[model samples]
Target chain A: MTFWGDYRGHGHPHESSWTMLGPLVVLAVLSIVGGFVFNVPEILSGMFPIKEATENGGPGEMVLTGISVAFGLAGIALSWLMYVVNKDIPEKITSSLGGVYTLVYNKYFVDEAYDAAIVRPLVQGSESVLWKTVDAGLIDGTVNGMGTQSQGVGSLLRLLQSGNIRSYATWVVIGAVVVIVVMGVTR
Target chain B: MNLLEILIALPAAGFLVTLFIPRKQEHLTRSFTLIVSLLAFVLSLGLVTGFETGKPGQQFVDNVVWIANPDIHWHVGIDGLSLWLIILSTFLTPIAILVSWRYIHKQVREFFAFLLLLEFGLIGVFAAWDLFLFYVFWEVVLVPMYFLIGIWGHDRRIYAAVKFFLYTMAGSVLMLVAIIYLYTLAGTFDYATILDLFRSGRIGLSHTEETLLFLAFFVAFAIKVPLFPLHTWLPDAHVEAPTAGSLMLASVMLKMGTYGLLRFCIPLFPVAARENASWINVLAIIGIIYGALVAMVQPNMKKLVAYSSVSHLGFVVLGIFSFTQMGLDGAVYQMLNHGISTGALFVLVGMMYERRHSLAIKDFGGVATAAPWLATIFLITTLASIGLPMLNNFVGEFLILQGVAQAKFAWTAFAAIGVILSACYMLWMYQRVFFGTQGKEPGETVKHHMPDFNVREWLCVVPLVVMMVWMGIVTQTFLPAVSATDASILDQAGTASALARPPVPPTGGITHGGSLHAR
Candidate 1:
């Protein structure tokens, strides 16, 4: 076996077994020495404004801090017990909750509720009301209606384009008479 | 010929030549269009080289009388605001031609002819100094794009094409009336002359007249920007358009709307823009959030990218309305960045479509394993799209946020939610399409036969990817050009507003951070 391969599976007896921890040990040592040398904690405390409140030492502030730390620790302990130490505890608790458990498990059916309430209506409304009714029925209907109307008007107007000079002259004379009558009355 | 004239004429000349090429000669038609687009791109570089940074006005001007009675001039030039956009147009056209190389089969000659025509119209829109010319070019863009989408597009092409045309045409009619009114007042259609007249109070308009005129132009551009409710046409148009059409639509064409806001809308009606800034910013913020939310649920890949453009462009509009130098600069830079990143995304999606003949997200799986190179590029673009740090989108988004924060902290906070939501949707889409198990079920008839990037595909994407990274890191290269223009815009807007109203105390004017403060 190659030396590295063997070492990966099993360590050499001559070497210290803790040699793998070398980097961590070095980091820890440096951190300790550097913290003391540089007064790191004091410097970091100076960076935060909350230090002023702490320095005032009000009983209210102390009580709030105490409550926060206590709750934080309790939460961590409970998570550890439920997740790492005894995972079945969570299942037991969930079973006791019954319907509530299902509710949480299914995310309270929020997605389904949203679909029924919002998405479905929106999709249906846009597809039918907005697109079909408004767009096609109203807008396109108006636009295409104009085109069709123009075409109908053009076909009707085509009657006047007959290539007969006598007929055209008679229409012009009649139009002039109507125009003069209307103009005279309006004036 | 001056460089600007050559830039405009080169594409037109190519378009004319493309018409004479026989339909069967596809290779000749493709190669000729490619060469023409590349030549235009090369000539446009001359503008960059000759351009004097920090110069206050338009360069390489080629003005001549086109219509004497109407006093219409064929005036064209590039300011700092337009210079990069012009380069962006030139840059993307060749890539677009390359993208359509194999995709467009029917009416090859006509396809390229329309493409060149579109390019010509786009370049002219950026370069034109005459409002009439600008309006003409603006309308000219619609014809080819209309046909490109209608004829060459996918399912629902006709409906999409008609909708696109009518929507844009309806908005622009008001603008045409407004332009004529301005011409009647100023007795000219030249932008500089009209701007001078408006600035000097020679062409006096009541507050109501100015606001109404502003709305006319704003409605036109807002439709083009397709902000929110007016954005109904964009998804259908983008989804139906062929690969190259989407690339052009998302890249350079959309910028025209934002560019008009910068060039004509704000500068021409500064008092109105200032008066209405709050409402416009609100709409922009809504669009940013609303677009991102809608994009998250999109099943179609192309639709997702299309919606993202709405969201991305919301930032541009937001930045413009912020009325700060940083904001304007970011808006302009974001336009180019969106062109590169989103344009590349469409190209990538197009390549996949070519292979699978499908864009449904469910149809893709383990594509990363099948095509690592494609996935790599897609991931980079996805990052850029979501504004990941060290990519192009981040710089623009950051600057926009900073600018917005200076103007309105609350709006900036809301716009930041869009940034997070973008990351969520993009990464989620990326994971689903790329990381899962390979292929569909065995019983399915369509067998998975995904191939990685071939040589031609690489050619299309490499430049875009390079640009995303380069623009992110060395943003100074592009920002200096934009800064001068943005500074002038802000200065003019400031002067215009100060002239009209009392100076309000500065609110939320925090000092900017970052090394880019040199600007």
Candidate 2:
């Protein structure tokens, strides 16, 4: 089938379009009704003519309720107008204040700034200084250095183990003389 | 045989029997090892049944003389402190062996044999009553663990193994020298005798002598507990070692260090321990925060887990240094909690590695879609590791924070940040691996290879998960057993030294109180 034919024949535009708006409208209406329903307890109590009813009733409460409802309805109407009736208004306003729009669009560049100021340096420092220089170079170097130093000492000591009778005799004679001289001096 | 002797000897006998098992009979070897570990675990439970709560001294005593010249003895026993740790050792061995069944295919006989040998050494380390015996067992642990890592470990295993050996040995040699010096002064290698001698003021130590001896043992245990700067060897050893090795290393082996601190360091040199506690607490806090921060950035899963262990164990050290009954109890309990949670995490990671053969975080995603059961268990373990309430780690971490808060409020507040950081890293890793839409790159043909836990793996992990919940819920059940011992240790330390901190009130019978002695 051709694309246009498929779109016209298969797509139920009226049903699908209503489905998108259905939940939002229902929620908005329910919330508005619910706001009044929440005052039922107070209204019912007022109708009972209790002794404290007149004491509790005042113009302040009425005025506060009127103001709240006025603001709430105004907000809802504005949202509907901006979102559905005149969708281009938000884009126009944002474009008019281009600097603030860009600021909000880029999330104030906080993440980029952090990456530049903190994360990059941290990662680079850890890799170069901590891992490379400290862990691998300094710490491991010192550890391995101990091993090599011991090995060097062992090899140097091994030189004295050379199997030579004349060398052993000479070393024994020198050791005996040194021992005798040390003992005599101490005594 | 006496219960403690059998508890120690069963594993030794298992090691001998494993030696005779033909290398080709892998199943037989595994079964034998499991059976022996199971028996050891069952007998270790006898310590619980036979143990009298609130009792002050060591039970299941098995003392015998071994050498005459330096007055050494084959003395071994269990107290409230050592009993749970002994049970922890025996408990993890069977699980360790079971987890290694598939992972360790080559040198099957030697692997199981060394594992059993390591178990024997670990039990001895916990149970030894004599200084010389403790030292012997301590060194014995090093040899087999070294071979376990070097033989069956991942690439770079040799370097890891050697570093472990050299680092541990360097700390231990100083300890050996100190032990010899103490022997000369007290004329015996018996722990009780030397402790009594020092306690009774018969063997007097000048200030320098006290500090030196304390440091000698402190360095040894700290390296093992791996507090802060001394902790560099742990990540390397943990990452390079096989799964079972990592489990034991994180679970029971690291406890040896903290246990040593409780068992020997504080009691032997209270003045120095109390004097140095401030700096030690500083190190502990540093380790707690440093470890978690480092873990947050780890690309390798095993390394991340390894760093978490450093963080968790730091709390244990912090608790011990806090020197309150709650702190020490939490420290001991945390030792066990870490074993369950972190060990289980390692096992899960190992299972994943077996399937995918890669431990890099980027290598896997949306694993839950493929293996929901495995993912669920991973999430549970991750939560437990992060100290979620009603999980094992939470009770321990809470108690530790409570304890440290009393001792050093600032340290506790800072250490609490580590808890948040732990959650950050563990959950972030979990999310990256399990919750995403794709576990691998698109068109990756090997996606079907990964599978959930089978019956054997379930058997391995079920006990851990159960214990994690059990310990978290009924902390009261475990706390009382160790409370009396913790109190006595602190009491002795407090009485021996002119401690600057206020005396910790006795913790006996005060369940859930906010005091340092809270049961």
Candidate 3:
């Protein structure tokens, strides 16, 4: 609809946004003619490499090109025949094959197929496996675990700063008794 | 007084002067601090210009009897190993000051004073040859950094400061004990003399003694390096530290650990170093992969960069442990590279924080649109951080990998994974933070408040950016000096390879030594 049909929106068109449109048009032109203008394999050299006549698609290439161009022209003519010449034909086709037409109209569930096949898995896996599980859950978890363990030990040791005279005296007595007992046993 | 002496003293004097500058006279304190740091940087450049690269051993030596009872001397100098590091310290200090010009508000004088004080300690770490003086300067560095993080830092500043202090202290006290024990054994705290004594067989370490002493020093430096398991304090400290503190901690201070490894550990306890290399390299590899993975998941910018340091420094440790000339040279080169690249990252993160008042990655999007120049500089820094070719890190990492490949091809393989992971986290962070749709959550904040590098910021960052390019392209200008020191260190370490090596071929002294290291 965008390329072959009219752009019939109700908004007034100001000067086209050349900043965005310019490169896109340039790329569109390039796609149509750039291959003929430049040799891709020769430019890329090792990556693509120029081929001999057999590798370069000799007669087989011509047959494939002819087939592809014929199908393309046929599709364009059919669209123009149904829409421009006899508009009732599209309705008749849709009525004849209702469910299949709906399926075809919805683009054969391709977007859903793409989401299931490629997009969802990547997004979900990157989040859960890469970021959350490996990075945060394991590595950072270990780091924080070490921090907490150290803090636990520190908390246990902080009791020494209790400032209780009797507790200190008792510890000192214990130390002295232990020292004396060790000395006597060694002797 | 020697130029090295002046270089060390200049910061100490600036620190003292900054301390006396009254808090009310804020501009005076700021400008004076800037002037002092800049002057010191200028003085350091003299050392660079005058540095005779092919000359071996310490240059610009100074010695004074600091204590009579302890027999401690204030001996200081720089070899190729320390020269660039000291220059990095001086170079980063003024920029740290410049970046903090507006960031620090409450205790302006005290903050700048501590920064200079931190400079004083860092230089001393790099410069001091005597063990006791090294320890003194070592302790000196901790105090100001403690206050800097504790005072000016984010919410958990106190917790971070204490943890940073305790972790370092835990390593330092054991080191002190070892230093004292060594003194009792050798009757002096002079490093060169002790090395000479050890070489001449006048004094010796039985195997157990060397290992223990090596551990004592190694653990302390390791804690600072925050190598692997001991690195927990680093993330907390970095996350909480103010911009200047983070910049210093990431850049110059971490080098102290790698520098210590080269300067003291390998040379002083060659047997112990060799014995420990397998396990240490394992830990380094673990740190490399682990840090990059953790960095990947971090929501906070500073935390991501902090973990990246762990990964980057792991490469350095691997290089050092590889026990090859390529390894040591690469290790030292990586030290300077990390100081500049990571330092610049921290500074850039700080700039973003200043605008957004948040470190959360989610808080920023399309920052490139708002601040194109800032984004450009950051992209360059990011590329540098990931060891892109023609950047400073590439040369260092390549050398390290080559060296490690020579030692153990397996270790090289593991370490190489880190290089790829570094690119993953850094470029990911850049894309999310810089290239996305502008003004998502903090859209209004960024569009209005986020300006590109102002004059002061440009002044601060351009030097660092230029340095990244300068060091990357002109490796020869720096490597000759570094290679010299690394060679001497390896020779002194008496590695198995060195011990089993052929004797000097007629031509003696540095030319033969220089030829040995030239590869």
User: Which residue pairs collide, candidate 3?
Assistant: B439-B443
Q: lDDT score, residue A84, model 3? A: 75
Clashing pairs in 1: none
Share of real interface contacts recovered by each model?
A: 0.00, 0.00, 0.05
Model 3 RMSD vs true structure: 6.6
> Can you write out model 2's per-residue Cα lDDT over B155-246, one digit (the tens) per residue?
99998999899999999999999999999899999998888887777778888998999999999999999897788888889889999999
The digit string of per-residue lDDT tens for model 1 on A102-186 reads 9999999999999899767755664566546764477557766765887899999999999899999999999999999999999
Lowest-scoring 10 consecutive residues by lDDT in candidate 2 chain B? B509-518
Ranking by TM-score: 2, 3, 1
Compare candidates 1 and 3 on DockQ and give the better one. Answer: 3
Docking class of 1: incorrect
Ranking by DockQ: 2, 3, 1
DockQ of prediction 2: 0.16
Q: After superposition, how far is residue A36 of candidate 2 from its true place, in Å?
A: 8.9
Among these predictions, the greatest TM-score belongs to 2
**Model 1 bad stretches (over 4 Å):** A1-187, B437-447, B500-519
Native-to-model Cα distance after best TM-score fit, residue B164 in candidate 2, in Å: 1.6
Over B1-519, each residue of candidate 3 has an lDDT whose tens digit, in order, gives 988888888888988888887779999999998999999999999999988886877888887888887789888988899999999999999999999999998989999999988998988888898999999999999999999999999999998898799878989999999999989988999988887777777777877898899899999999889798678788889999999999999998888888898999888887678777878889999999878877877889999999899999999999998878998899999999999999999999999899889898877878898899999999999999999888999999999999888788889899998998888889988988887754464334346678888899999899999999998999998999999888888877663324423453656532211123323
For each of the candidates, the C-alpha root-mean-square deviation to the true structure, in angstroms, is 7.6, 6.5, 6.6
Residue B359 of model 3: what lDDT?
A: 94
Say which prediction, candidate 1 or candidate 3, comes out ahead on TM-score: 3
